[model samples]
Target: MAETGTAPSVLYEERSQRLLDQVALKETDRTPFVFATRFWAAKYAGITFEEQMYDAEKSAAALEKVLVLLEPDGYVPSLYIFGPTLSALDYRLMQWPGHGTDRNATFQYLDREYMPAKDYDEYLFDPTGYCFRKYLPRVAGAFEGLAGMPDFPSLSEWRFVGAMRAFGRPELRESLRRLLEIGERAEEAAQKSVAFVKRMAALGFPSAGGGFCKAPYDHVSDFLRGSKGCMLDLFRNKDKLLEAIDKVGELLLRGVVEETRAGGTPYVFIPLHWGLDGFMSPQHFQTFYWPGLRKVMLRLIEHDLIPVVLWEGDCTSRLELIGDIPRGKAVYWFEKTDLVRAKSVLGDTVCLRGNVPTSMLIAASPDEVDEYCKMLITKVGKGGGFILDGAASIPDEARTENVLAMAKSVRKYAS
Candidate 1:
């Protein structure tokens, strides 16, 4: 390890300067550093995945520990604010009642016994106080817990899934009300989460952590809401589906953008919920994903916030589809994606971030991680668009040697 210490003022200044230069779409003295870390945070801190999700204090501690240790060229990662996290422990709870925080980590559709006939104004989504009125109390409650240790249920409480909750209406409206209530709570949770992030941003190291961004298929796939249902709705009620997506983006991004600008953080996060390869093909990506993404990015840009998308799963198949995005608009947190080709294609447009194997991090020695990262820095960092980062969270169980290797390799090379 590079002596777990705080990055010196010189290093911090140089990183910020270089990153700002990149943001301007210009060359810089050094390539910016980005951390695609998630579970790795808790692990590096000697904690468990369940604890990171459930305990805000532990999550913050881990984040700070990593920041102090690595002191990368840039501090940027998404704030994971889901209702309940999907830990292995939480997933098993699904078999019981309200919802599990472990086991399946998937959303199993609850058969709602009843529902409102599209008329309950206060309970329903109201344009004015809709966000605060419905969710503020829950936010207040969570804030208290987090004031101690709050958590949002991104999972099905009964299941161990991670996603938004707009799809799959149940047979009975009554039972559905609980889900709806959870949705309301989610909205409230998202709003408060943004505020909490803003507070964190102000309190600690300079960073770019923002609100939530879950997709339709994400909910369907993880929650077991049925992809067929969502795809069918795309054809049956395109406007509604579109509206739902827009609502989610607005709820999650808008507040964070405002807070980010006010907080003076240079970057913004767009955490994609669906997988890169399976959710929908490139053609379908254009039809559904692109338009919403364009609007979300555009809106945030209007507020002078930089959007760095966390593209998950194997998106190698969709590289060409993604390359169409305008250059300098965003940086991708690419997960398990093919790099050589991504650099060749997308390099001309957006800033490409990562693709290190998480499995290798868990199994390999420091030498392996070092060799791989060194090659990546040399190869991808060629034209000035690459950002050093893990393709996904360096798995919690990753060998400590692997983490050290990746870090040393990144700082070792002088661009």
Candidate 2:
């Protein structure tokens, strides 16, 4: 790999520290640039999206090309899912390239309600039971047999013998057999992901996020109930839904804390999907979204982990409400929200990242891209806490010259 400053190890340290300093609201020598992307690497490197998912080494090769050319301070890895791993579980949550969409197309999620509103009480009372018996079967075909199994929590002494009979069912036995295959594929995928990160480190590019998580409301609205079901529950099942959110929020926090600790990286990525202005009223956001999200962030901070939140849609109306946090402990990355206004509202409280229009990146001239980046650097990066990135992330169709211009402008103006 070509050296960034002098040597690979030395450059890695410098880049990692630059990101951490920006997170802490400290002025850096220059504003850090993080290339957050998914399929852009594959498209840029002349590989199909299917190749990026099914071939680990090829995906890394594609990502290496981008890192060598752009040399951003850090990057969100371009390859995350392994197709074979999902195939093992017969996962139904998303339809990936070559599976549901065209080989060159990006993965698409199916947003049907996996958990109906009537099951809220059961989930609140025994989430483990609900996941195994109710939730798993709905989302993954591999777990259809699990639906027949009795709740283990109620088993004891003589009751245990009856539970064993449930496992003896042919379908349940087949599910257990399939689980072994899933476990093997999952372990292989985990190792490849670890190796991929290590390879990026050796190339002198630190990953922008160490771990991943989501707000409790998003977890529910996204996976459990569909957006429509969850929204209607606000009026029909308020008490039960609130109870379930707290239970799931605590579980998510514990799991993420453990994962981040094991990964030994300071930044935890939390993508907020349901908290945008178009999703709910301000009162509903205050009641259902921010409190649970704030709890998760505070818990992460207590453990010395920084929560990097991506507000995916326009959240311009909710900026002030979102700023009630300890300064220098988090980052709020915006997708469509006005960055200049965000900087004014949250400049002193948290690190700011992104708002580059993806449309501009895909269609505008390189000079137009450079001008936009210059404006962002001069206005938002005027203060200490800022990092340059795409609005959501680098679009799959973004022009190479436009991205190069973004990277170039950062050094030209911020440095």
Candidate 3:
């Protein structure tokens, strides 16, 4: 890889050294820090979600704002930009079939499907103008409710919001063309994507996305198809469901892994499920949701990539089933997960992060943030395997001071 020269590289190396310490299971200059955010940053910039999404300057400025405020030991930008920036020309083609709540694909989730019509599977491979009618309104309007709401995620997006804000209609169109075309056109797109990303690595962020894995159920519901279809396939033609994931899993993971490798990311994100807790029981998660992801995670770490699984929805109740994850090859980002049990089952093998209440950032005092963060560090930050993040992305409802204080205190006290 050609080195991105000067200060950015210098800062990257500096941060890398600290993260490297954590990865090695040794004490770093300080505890390693990591947080995924956009809402928090947008609030600081005084810009709407629209401004942040289409304007790069606003995105970066907002990022700088977060850096200035929280100054955490680690960071990961939100995924709001990639689809909009790299695929803008085909934004109409690339479907984001997310409901307000669905972020993971299926194995185990709630008793709902964002796209109940997924059983048709007609939309999976077809690219028709008709599908655009239903998809576009939701895609553009996902944040429409937030148009008047303060600190919308779209407004603060650097590539999506920032770029659109700065560029003329023609320039925006050309950039999108450069970004959307696959292979050579895709090559150009990836390069432009890399430029912004390299800037981040150069600006001192530790890179890792090769390990990006979320529950496929969310993917099922949002992108290719939805849970309603997948679940039906699972029950009616179990073999077909298995075979389909076997093929799709490789393709989805290969791109995420390759992108992370391309960007030189070390730690990648994985959210696991088949739906334990309120959604489904532990047995179901292991059989349907996790087996496929388990294969994916195994392959990821086999290549020396570290997997950070965001175990959403009360995964604390189901660790015994999932505990077999390759130890020391990954860390757990526990959301609504039980940390004590996680530490018992996962502490020795994998690193652990999170479990702080999302509501804490919105309503808790700084002392409360500090106390909760301090508690997590005390419980999980031992032996150098933990990094601090939230059970979920710190939301717009979270108080800025509380969020900043959470990061500050976690870094200050985490082992």
Candidate 4:
């Protein structure tokens, strides 16, 4: 590692500047640190997972405590907010907190055919309409009444007064009540989330990104079709699947354009779920996954937004494919990809973040953690296009001292 022997002295603005500089592949004082703390924030605050999900105040407070203690340059605020909302609706897609699963277990998304193979034509014809009418109602029982609602253009014509009367039914009323309750709780949590982000900023930590997107393949696979269903469609209904993927990609890009017009942060978080090497062969990835995702990345770049692509699984073989992204326009945060090879292939093209083992953070000693981070900084942080972060989110069991070693190594080695 290049050692300057300079004391650690980065204020809020300078810290933020250093992060942006690193993303832009420019020289900076040192590598910036971005930590991903999910359920771990609740544990750090000494609160039960249930309390952290239901209690907005407690959740925000816990996240603030974690950020203050760790002092990372940037962070994702609260991953705990969705549990209560999902629970209230008895959402079948995910099990979390005390609902549909163990009280202490982290959130688990169930893979089932929410949209069966037969519905491909409906989905491709009108993705938004199908989602609201067929998909949402089937996934969440509370939204079943939506299936009876009239189309948007015909609603003003009063063509469905009889359908509107469905809301008066006791069962529908009960569902609406639950929906309102969840909505109110979600809105309150959102307010707390905004306050937490501001507090992190005041404490010298900017947000890693303001919004996030999913790869189009994941957009379909994760929600519409289960892994088995999607894989089958890849063989039986390849043409329809590709068309849907392209449409979804266009829709997501349009949403990004609309959202970023006002200009907040330049970073767009993209947590890729289904495009990993294990999910498909190289040809399938290049065909079904990369095309839509590449278009999304290019669109974001065109709009001057940095696409932060979080590779969620082993992507060693896919690194060169991802390198097609323009240089200095994106950040690729890897989870299980080989870091040394990542630096070798993508080092010159994009700003690379992470590969620190979650196991090390949870099981290793502080010195062991320091040595591992030092190795990453020395090799991966050689040039300026690197940020020190964990391979995945910090688990609830991760040792505090080990987490601190990450920051310590960045300061000692990078400087």
Best by lDDT: 2
Compare the candidates by TM-score and give the number of the best one.
2
Give the clashing pairs for model 4.
4-415
Candidates ranked, most accurate by TM-score first: 2, 4, 3, 1
Tens digit per residue, CA lDDT, model 1, 1-415: 3423544555555666666566555666655666545566766787655555555566667776776566566555443434243221123212321244352132233322111213123322543343323332232232111111112333445444322222232322332444455566566545655555454444334454443344433432233223555565556656655555565556556466666666556577666755468877676677677666767776766766677777887777877766655567677778777777787888777777776788888887788787888777777777677777777756656777677677677667754
Superposed Cα deviation of residue 97, candidate 3 (Å): 14
lDDT of each: 0.57, 0.87, 0.59, 0.80
- Residue-by-residue lDDT tens digits, candidate 4, 120-161: 998887777897678988888777766654465446545566
lDDT score for residue 247 of model 2: 84
> Once superposed on the true structure, which residue ranges of model 2 sit more than 4 Å away at CA?
1-5
Give the clash total for candidate 2: 0
Better of 1 and 2 by TM-score: 2
User: How well does each candidate superpose onto the true structure, as a TM-score?
Assistant: 0.67, 0.97, 0.72, 0.92
User: What value of lDDT does candidate 4 attain over all alpha carbons?
Assistant: 0.80
Worst 10 residues of 2 by lDDT: 1-10
